[model samples]
Target: MSHVGKSKILFVDDEEVICSMAAEFLEMQGFIVDTYEDSREAFDAFCRDPDDFDIVITDQVMPKMTGIELLKNIIGIRSAIPRILCTGFSEELNHKDEKEVGIDAFFMKPYRFDDLIGQIKKLV
Candidate 1:
């Protein structure tokens, strides 16, 4: 179902399995997904070609850097790209914090793929 003009996504998570799985799922839905298991590395990739991606979906509580920190850095360079924070640790971030962090959307862990798709479509 891949399309030439599908929205490109950068999905970051310290957990390799989670990132890979989500990437596969999103890809099947026709999105171009690039998965990163390290937030720091993801930042570097984003910096190298910020315009290559349309949106970013990342997990919180990473090793070298947190997702919020990554989003902040990305915004500093390119503020218009949509960002989504997806984490199992809901207590670590709330609606107010998400807004303060400049994320366009927030999704809790175990979110439905369809719901995520809807948000992605809405954002991009």
Candidate 2:
């Protein structure tokens, strides 16, 4: 099912290529996406418009704030928004613990766009 015009996503990653690629792909799929390479900046943007996005997708290993840290701050502001954490360091994550901390989904790095879309569809 196409979420065309139905959802807006806030996506953050420290990697420029990943951010650009994901944003491009998501936009093509008809979902409005705001991409950021800086976690702090992304958090600030989200804070300014907490209700603007339907979902949050973030990379785990960022410079200033980790994905988990960002998600924590996000949920503190608006607990209802669904959060997805993407990371290359799977071993660093404790799935059960992350769920407790407010992550609704996880995407390992180098993931297929189809899988990401499927997870997004599931969440909203």
Candidate 3:
């Protein structure tokens, strides 16, 4: 789905393929996406300029920091910016936990691109 405005998104995933593909897909759908393969780096970038991004989409599992951790840090810095957490099936996260963390949305791996885009449009 094409978004109304050029929403800038920060997408973080340890897997380069997923990160690259998602970034390209979002860009194609009329969003400006910045992708990172390292969660810490992504967090650093976010802290550097939180206002540069309209939304954040991050994968749950990573080497340096988990997606939730990154989101937590982001929350401390800029809670108002919408955050979306995406993960493969994990016992660690339930809907309750996500809600407690205050993320705007949660998506599982292999998510439908259209569905994710739709959620993003609503949030942004």
lDDT of 2 at 1: 21
Tens digits of lDDT, candidate 1, 50-122: 8888999999888999898999899988888989998888778755656867887888888887898889988
Overall lDDT per candidate, in order of appearance: 0.86, 0.88, 0.87
lDDT against true structure, model 2: 0.88
Q: Give candidate 2 misplaced runs (Cα > 4 Å).
A: 1-4, 94-97
Name the candidate that leads on lDDT: 2
- The window of 10 residues in a row where model 1 has the poorest summed lDDT is 1-10
Ten residues in sequence with the least summed lDDT for candidate 2: 1-10
Which rank order by lDDT, best down to worst? 2, 3, 1
Q: Write candidate 3's Cα lDDT for 1-124 as tens digits.
A: 2246699999999999998889878989889989999999999999888889899999987898888888888888888888899989677676665775698888888898889999999999
Q: Where does model 1 exceed 4 Å of error?
A: 1-5, 94-97
The residue ranges of model 3 lying beyond 4 angstroms of the native Cα positions read: 1-3, 94-97
TM-score of each: 0.90, 0.91, 0.91
lDDT comparison, 1 vs 3, better candidate: 3
Please rank every candidate by TM-score, starting with the best: 2, 3, 1
Q: How many clashing residue pairs, candidate 1?
A: 0
